[model samples]
Every structure is written in structure tokens, then in C-alpha cells.
Target: MRTSLQFIFLLVYASVAACCQGQEVTISPDVVYGHKSGLAMTCDVFTPEQDANGAAVLFMVSGGWFSNWSPPEQTQHMFKPLTDKGFTVFAVRHGSSPKFSIAEAVDDVRRSVRFIRGNADRFEVDPDRIGVFGMSAGGHLSLMLGTASDEGNAESKDPVEHISDRVNAVVAYVAPTDLRVMAKDAPDRLPAYDRFPALEIDAKSATADSPIIFVTADDAPTLLLAGAKDDLVPISYSRNIEAAFEKAGVTSELIEFENAGHGFGGEDAKKATEAMVNWFVTHLDK
Candidate 1:
């Protein structure tokens, strides 16, 4: 029994070592986005290989519209696991809603991708093959990055104003796609906010800015993973966006988990992760 256990340990170590060798891992944080009062967003860049002209993924963290919790270790589950599979990953953070409006958070994510793409050579990443992924609100942001781009200016001095942040592909896990619908019907499931003055579903450009509203044939391919039982971010979120994707003749897919909820764990979550990885492999790993 002792010998068997030792042999298994040795095998695991060897596999992990083999996967990690020749891979350069960098966890750079506080990548400044702008200069305001305490005005700087942070992200951790995880570069896995030196020779990787491969696609990179920006993994956005899932906090609700309210700005309270920092992204925890579980947030790493989406990106770090992908790094071992030979991809560069960036964990992006943005100011939360209420404290910052949806417009502000959207712009923050857009700027983060632009910064990563602009520094592609420095990071050994492929500029044209970047992808984005997130869960819940972060997922919605990821999809927005893929769909909405009126072609941003790339020559400004403002770090946030200097580039187009469009991505090649997107993966969203139980994200709110139609904020108008969500804001109206989802408050019961969402976090109760007595302080931030609950926003109206129809308020301030949510309809026009929704990922579902922006889908087109020119949009990037998308992979949406939703839990059927997700109360906070209903399965209807993915369905609405998918309907729009099909109408626009864009390539996108939604994988629904029968027994999962808003946030998943266990075998169901693993399957969802595998599906997401395969989606990126198909669309962005070319």
C-alpha cells in the first residue's frame, strides 16, 4: 500500500513538472488604468510560456452589480487551470456598479483587453487571438467585449483611450445578458441592495448596451454556459443572447447544465469548465 501511494505521488509530480517546465509564470498586479483619486484598476497576468504566440484569455471576476467582495481563490479556478494547458491568462478587475456605473465597468474591461493586446509583443501573446471569460456579471462583461465595438481609437495618451479591446471569442458562465430584463425581474434572486438604490431595468442605456442587443454576423464566436436552475442569473439570460446570435447569423453555442444553480461546483462545474476550454481551443487556439 505504501509503495503504491509513493508511486502515485511520483507520477503526479512528474506530470505537473513536465507541464510547468519552459513555462514563464508572471503574476503582475496593479496594472494602472488611469489617474483619479485612488484611481487604478489591478489585474494579474499569468504567462505560461516564453515561446507562446498563442491566444490569451482575460478572466473577469464575478461580483454582483454591487461593489463589496473581492474576487477570491475560486476565481482562479477559471484561469490558472487553463494556464497549465498552455495558454496565457489575465485576471482583470474593474470598479463595481453603483460605485461605478455599468458604463464605467464596461469601459474598464474594454481598456484592460486593449492594454493586453497592445503589449502583446511584450507578453508573447497573439494580438488577434485574445479571448475573454467570466461568470455572472463578469460573464456579461465578457460577452459585451466580444460583441460591442464601434472601433475605439488607438492613438490617445489616455491608457484607457488608446486601443480597440475587441476579443476573438467569449465564454460566459450564467451571465446576465439582457440587463433590462434582469434588472426588472431578477431583484428577488439578486443581492438586496438598500444602499445603492436599485436601478430600473430600463434605466440608462441597458437596452442599447446589452450583448444581446449588439450581436451581429461580424461579432466574435461565443460560448455560453448556463445552469438551468440558476436563480440569480437565470438560464433565460443565455437563451436571450443565443436567440439574438442566431438571428444575427453569428456563431455561438449555449450549454445548459440540468442540475446546477447560479454558481456551480462538483462534477457539473468541471464539465462546464471542460466545455469552455474546448470552445476556446476551437475558436481562439487556431
Candidate 2:
């Protein structure tokens, strides 16, 4: 039997492929954003053919901390909802786990943002209006960008490093907020940690990687969508982050699909996608 997470992934993929047919968008595939250990890190840029919005959104192409690549043309349908609304999208791939740790993945994504922001003019996007969206491990990465961003290193030699990584808004689905719960010796440690070596960490390291630890008043406005029936990442993760956002006076909302699992399908999928598009429109379209 497939796990809830796996099932949801397939369902969401099939639903998106089925509904997002014939979207007119220009795709620039494998644009190098940065380099890691002499390897080029890349993102596929999707620009709407009409009504091109200056704002940009980065989609973290990660699942279970494993960043995989597919032909941009094959996956372009997945971004139709955002493109239909005239939002430019960048599908960002981070360094995969088993070879890279969660901490390294975070660093890779942060660098990707810096590169995109520094080259915003080339991409025809507003540097200050960037947003991010992801699901599962990707969602966790999105939250990391939202809460732990810096104002850029002015003295850095690389021009890209001089641009801030902070995003204007965030939308995460079923993200793990407090990674400390996955500490190796924790009583409630994730049961499948062995399968995702990225979660193999001590309590101290987990705390360092947890998005909840970095939340502050100035963090990006965030929208979290979660399935109440999610078995992989409990709904409490989103609930806790929502509470933290509220306490910090940040604009945030959490929408729960009571009947869905780790991923949404059918009406729930449509609702979540709409909610995501609207959140970016309200926050990034200023």
C-alpha cells in the first residue's frame, strides 16, 4: 500500500496534468542561478505570454528533501494556475539529500533567491516583490526563506550575494515547521527518518534548521494550506506556525482541508490552488 504522502503526490500530479491543458506561457529552461562545488544550480523560468506581471514567484521543486529534475516542458502544466494570473514563476531545484543535508538545501535555495533578485531586470521581474511556494519538503524550504532571510552581505565579492534573499510572501502546503520534532532521540521522531536521510540530525541541529525558531514581526506574510487528515506532516505543524505568525503580528492565514491527506485532490486541490494564487495577488501585487 502506498503511504499517504505518495498517494497525495500522484493525485496532485495527475489532477494538475488533467486540468492545466493548453496554457500559453514561454518557458526558459535550466537557467543557471548559482553553482555548488563547481556544479551549476538551475531553475526553469516561466513567463506568461500576456499581461506579464512584474512580480515573481519561486516554486521549490522538492519532495521529501529530494530535489529532482524533469523536462521543463513536461512540468510547465503544474504552474498554469499561477501563470494564468500573469505571475512569472521560477521552479527552483535545491541540492538533493543523501548527498546534501537539509541545512545545505536551505543554503542553496537562499542563494537561488539572491541570484534571481540580483538579475531581476534580466528576468523582467520586480526584485522586491518576489514570493515563494512549495509543498512538503519544498514547503519547509519556503518557510525557511520567509523567516530566516538576511539583508544581503554588502562586502561580498559576488554581486548576487549583495542582494537580499528575503521574499515578500510565502505559501506552503503541509510543511514541517518545527524540525526539532524529528530529532534522532525524540520520542515523536518521524518514523520514516531512515528513508529521508535529510531528517537525520541531533536536537541542536534540528533547532537550527527549524523555521519556527526564526519567526519575527518582519517575516514575510504567509499563507499555509494543510490537510487535516495528513499523516506525514501533522496539521499541528501549520497550526503552530499560524500561531507564531499571529503572535508576531505578521499577516498569515491557514486553510485546512478536513477531508484531504498530505496532498489535495478534486475540490480541495482546486481550492488550495485558488487560495495560493489569491494570496500572492494580494501580497505581491502591490
Candidate 3:
């Protein structure tokens, strides 16, 4: 269930004092999380001087799954809030679509979770407290991470594959819930929509791997924020997921901005960010 508008503002204002008191942060260069299609899938890590509550946040910043990753400097501002909360942040990038699909992106995120948790001590993080966050297609992948996490395979020769990929929490923005509804209602908003008809991200093909279909009570606690007027990936994208989470008795929330659209910014962005911070704090800090 969603929080009230007053609660959102109060939560934001009240939590401002809980920040890490302007702690400095250390950053990591692009480190490989996985290798596929002869490409190095990597991420940048930001570590607060105070060790960030001994937890790490995995950020998937891909837009429509086509990521253009740069050095940590270019994206530092985005993670400042998390760092202020004393949470290490990992900006994760995945292979693009058209050339790559949602399936690969899903694998990339799950693998990143395993990689970060597997190296938690080296990174000075709590292996049990990794939380995933993203917007749009990235958010969709984050949801997949929440719904499809698994204990690593003991039989696997690769250690990373043997490390659990489950995250404690998720914060998603404007993400599609069902690829079937997404493709049918607004194919133009989907990645590689030009070939959507032939793509496997539909109802007839929706599998346990598809995020929406994959959800269960075991899914991570999630906070979803969206714009009521978003025509691209409509608020229904999140609403449907909210319903699914409720049906499965998963802890989830949805906030719909009455006056907003696809681009969530200004005051709405502040609220969304605050909601995310509160969600992470409540779910991860424990």
C-alpha cells in the first residue's frame, strides 16, 4: 500500500537529519560483473567514508536498456543522497537492447548483485543488505532482481554463480510491470519496439523469468513511484505490479503524481527520492 502525501513530506523532512553528516566517499573504477557477447559488463562503486551503514545499493541507470557508462565522476551526483545516508552505491550498466534483450539485462543485474555480495567484505559492506534501484527499463530489471533472486549453485565452478543474488529491497520508478501489457498498450515506449511483435516479451511467452510473472511473496520489499500522466509507460505499469505484489502479500507501495508525466523532476522528483531513501532505510538498515 502507498503512503499518504503528508507522510511522504514528513518522512523526507524528518529523515534529512539522519544523513551521514556530509561524509566523503571513495569510488571504484569500472569493475567487471560479468562478460557476455564479447563485452565487459561493469559497474562503478561509491563508498562512504563511514562505510555507509555497512550496506550497498546497486543502481541500474539504463534507459530502455541502452546504457552509456562513464567514469564514476559523471554519475557521482546521482549517488550523493545514498552516500549521505552512509550507503555504498554501485552504478551498474548492462548490454543494450535491439542487440541485446531484457533477458540479458536481467541476468546482468542478478549477476551484479552476486558479485557485490560476494565481495561485500572487500568493499566493507553488509552482504545481506544490498538494495536495488533504477528508473524505466532499469527499474524493470531491478524488479526482476527482487523477484528472481536465488542461492548460488554449490555445484558451479564459478564462485560468483554460487553466491546468492537476492537483494533486501527495491526502489523502482516508471517501470513496466507486464511486458505483455506494456507491448500491447504502448509498444512505442518499449525498447526495440520496432520489432516488438517478434520479441519474446509478451503474455504468450511470459515466463518465470519475466519480472511481473515471476513475483512471489519472497520478492523483496519494493517502493514504486510513477506519474499519473505518463503516456509512455503509464502509471498502470506500476499499478498492475502493485496489485500483483498485494495479491502475493509482498510489501510494496506505489505513488502516482497527479500532475506529472514521463519525466519526473522538480518537487515530484524530490518526493520520489525521499520515498526511495525512506524505503531503503526502513528495509536495508535493518
| Per-residue lDDT value at 71 in model 1 | 41
Expressed as tens digits, the lDDT of each residue in 1-286 for candidate 2 is 1133423553485476467454589999999988888899999999999888899999998887888878988877778888888889999988887789899999999999999998889999999999999888889999999999998999999888888999999999999999888778678886866566787788888897899999999999999999999877899999999999999999999999999878888888888888999999999985
Relative to the unseen true structure, what is the Cα RMSD of model 3?
Answer: 6.3
Better of 2 and 3 by TM-score: 2
Q: Record all residue pairs in model 1 with backbone atoms less than 3 Å apart, i.e. clashing.
A: none
Supply the TM-score for candidate 2.
Answer: 0.95
The local distance difference test score of each candidate is: 0.69, 0.87, 0.76
Off by over 4 Å in 3: 1-21, 184-192, 195-203, 206-209
Worst lDDT 10-window in candidate 1: 1-10
Tens-place lDDT per residue, model 3, 53-166, is 988898885766666656677556567778888898898888776577767777788889999998888888899898998777778888888887889899998888999999
Q: Deviation in angstroms for 231 in model 3? A: 0.6
Best of the candidates, lDDT:
2
Q: Scored by Cα lDDT, where does model 2 land?
A: 0.87
Considering only N, C-alpha and C atoms within 3 Å, which residue pairs clash in candidate 2? none
Backbone atom clashes (below 3 Å) for every candidate? 0, 0, 1
